[model samples]
Target: MPQSSPRLIGVGGGKGGVGKSIVALTIARVLSDRGDEVVLADLDLGAANLHTYLGIHGRVPTLSDFIAGGMADLSPLLVDTPMPRVHLIAGGVGSLKTANPTFQSKMKLLRHISRLSADWVVLDLGAGVHYNTLDFFNAAHYRVVVTQPEAGAVLNAYGFIKSALLRRISRVFSKDKNLTKALEERVSTTRSRGLLTFCLTDRLSMSPILRGLMMNTGRD
Candidate 1:
């Protein structure tokens, strides 16, 4: 899972009307102007409007439509933007099935993403910490989390990071033989010490995570 492909950039702001998409579009334009082949992907599969700045209109082919058992091809859907070297992949408004695709569909989409030939793939995520946004953000190589100067925005941003970290850790450690066995054995048991400390010194003792690794395990 060591990434060795085109760099992927994702932009996500905590609250609505925080200029997240505007910043993404601007950055895409600047990079495109510099002759970088950038494909701005609208990961916001709910309400997407990045194409407006480029003078695109009407219903477009999108990720949702692809996930909803429809056909999609890069040549047919890579809409030309006003900026040179910059293309667009629009997202569809969500419904029941199109909003939350099945696991198989996600895997299929990811597999197809690797086939895209571009220097940069920029993902514009929707506001808030919904699963749709965070999952897409996690898929990117580098994440740009934006937040306003407000308590609520800060909390939401933190929550997004925490959720992403938790999911990543779960995926990484889920298949480890010792760690998985130990966690499953002790997940519901009262160990020698507190559950938190048990987690530190026993289940994932070798984990380099700042939380479990740095906690004082001497009490156990």
Candidate 2:
């Protein structure tokens, strides 16, 4: 069997109105300008406005169609932009029926995305640390979180990163009760639970389970 080529990307940030979408679209344009076949998926779920930046101004059929038992594959829903090597899985419509699919569903979408025949898949996500946005950002091999030098932007970016890392840690410690307690204590910043100490220490007494997770989550 032939090995499939890898094609995935993510551009996101914790700061609102920071022009991350514009950057993503412009990068897609450059990639398309170089004859790269690119598919931009607005993975922001609830607030997907990437199409507007690309000058697409009509009703867009989205993954909501397929997820809600629409008989068509995602292709018919690929919104065309003026860029030659670019196509889009627009996010302009939704159904209340199958609302807020699980994180597993998001992963399923990502798995299916890996099978698509494209040179690049650029994804633009919304601002925040919501599970959906974080999952989408972490799913790609190349993930970039845009941020300004402002304090609010930096703090929110820290919050977003903390949430993502803790979520992964929770997953690894999901089965170990004692480890979970230790995690809470370690992640906490109170006098009883010194997260600051952990941060300013040479080593944390994390369980093997948590150590493995920390390694995988880049917390080490």
lDDT of 1 by residue, 69-186 (tens): 6566454568888788888988776465656677687667656665677777788888876766776777776666666667887666555655555455455687786875565455
Can you write out model 2's per-residue Cα lDDT over 1-38, one digit (the tens) per residue? 11464467777778787766776787677677767788
Alpha-carbon lDDT, every model = 0.66, 0.66
Colliding residue pairs in candidate 2: none
Model 2 regions more than 4 Å off:
1-5, 71-73, 93-99, 180-220
> How far is 63's C-alpha from truth in model 1 (Å)?
1.9
The number of the candidate with the highest lDDT is: 2
| Per-model TM against the reference | 0.72, 0.74
Q: How close is candidate 1 to the true structure, as a TM-score?
A: 0.72
Which ten contiguous residues of candidate 1 have the minimum total lDDT? 210-219
**Per-residue lDDT value at 82 in model 2:** 85
